[model samples]
Target: MGLLGFFTRKPHERAGFELYSAAVGAARRPGFFAGLGVPDTLDGRFDLVSLHVALLIRRLRRDAAAEGPKLAQAVFDAMFADMDVNLREMGVGDLVVGKRVKRMWEAFHGRAAAYEAAIDAGDLAALEAALTRNIWRGEVVPEGAAARLASYAQALAERLAPQAMADFTRGRARFDVEVPA
Candidate 1:
């Protein structure tokens, strides 16, 4: 390591940021709003983003790569960093930014915990319940909407499970990249 190392981010940090950007892209897919009826409001968008990011972290943790945990932590940090930037961009006052970010951080963790637990258990019904609660705040979704979203999440997780760690370390988001390397 050298002084330049001090000035620039290490590869893992960049990879994490890239991966988080990918999650955001997945969350923004219009099907969620138009078909699935995701609220399209700020809170709704935030929940979707959190769901995708948690999925990535969960997938990363399942792999045996030596970098997996580091990458997962980096992904988590990148997400909150993004939240902080978004808050500032939205003109949130500096004095309350930390508090607001904290609340969001807690919210993400709670949702992530529910998501991870349900997925790990292979309990689609549990996942559906959690998704319904988080995405719609227990309001009735169009019939079968939660189930459909749960299926989508499960499919994405499976799609990601066998992905090469190389794509991730290279800062090529495995889930969202449009071109082959």
Candidate 2:
């Protein structure tokens, strides 16, 4: 088994694994990677990428516990941040990057649609299934796509990990205290 195998081996881990994998695969497309300014040595950063993925999972899990539409929005936001870094670092065209961003947007909307369907049908199992599927299975991007996405995710994860870890360790922070009347 390989490093990716660790991600694929556990069904429970598949959702988060595939989420980052899809972004990586998307960024690795010929025009995509070329447009993004990705170099040829992304594989060198695999370990760091793994750390980002772990952080992404942690963030997602934390956000999911919150009420309202924020959870989905946070997921979408994270995806965008990862995509932005890829495009910005690679010096890709705005048009190309925008197209890629739309693709990501659609993916999140699709996820929401699935979640809504499950909810409308009152099938919690379906929601769980949709949320857990390995969406990136059999997806192939250009040679370095996975690495690019992983690295991007890692960088973003690194940015968030300090705060994210604090949240994990200290539990959720309170923004407002109730006043006794």
Candidate 3:
């Protein structure tokens, strides 16, 4: 840690925060809840954001560069910070906020692991099941909603997988818009 390191902004850190913001923005897209039938509640929204963040982290981890891990950590940090702020806004007490944040971290990790495994296996059905359980909370969802959400996830992953690391580092990463069928 040198004086310059402290003074100058790191590229990975900046990119990670930008990526986090992008994920949150994507989750807030009304199409998912309105058109796709994802629940609009807090848990539903968190699951969607977690899914987006997991995808980004997965891509970053696949990069061979040393900056990949740093950027991933930064993204994770940004997510928890956002969660903490959200919890506070929802009237969570300061004393119990730590416990609630810990639980949220656990939920995020569990969802990420499940999603990664399903994606790695190349099983769309598994991914759909995971989404149903996590996003829909094991409840019966509207017909085709789970499948449509699964398709969106797959499409989004495909779009993200080919993005240039240079573009990502420059905070120019793009996600596909949900086109009406």
The model with the greatest lDDT is: 1
Q: Write the per-residue lDDT of candidate 3 for residues 1-181, one digit (tens) a residue.
A: 7778878865577777788999889888988888767889989999999998998888878888776677888889889988899899989999999999999999999999988888888888989899999999976688888888877887788778888778777655576658222
**Stretches of model 1 off by over 4 angstroms after superposition:** 1-6, 176-181
TM-score of each: 0.91, 0.32, 0.90
Q: Give the candidate number with the greatest TM-score.
A: 1
- How high is the lDDT of residue 62 in model 1? 77
User: Could you tell which candidate, 1 or 2, scores higher by lDDT?
Assistant: 1
The list of candidate 3 runs beyond 4 A from truth reads: 1-11, 177-181
> For residues 45-96, could you state the per-residue lDDT of candidate 1 as single tens digits?
9999999899999988877998988898999999999999999999999999
Candidates 1 and 3 compared: the better one by TM-score is 1
lDDT (CA) for every model shown?
Answer: 0.86, 0.42, 0.84
In candidate 1, the residue pairs with backbone N, CA or C atoms under 3 Å apart (3 or more residues apart, or in different chains) clash, namely none
Better by lDDT, candidate 3 or 2: 3
How would the candidate models be sorted by lDDT, starting from the highest? 1, 3, 2
- TM-score head-to-head 2 vs 3, winner: 3
Candidate 2, residue 27: CA error in Å?
Answer: 17
| Clashing pairs counted in every model | 0, 3, 0
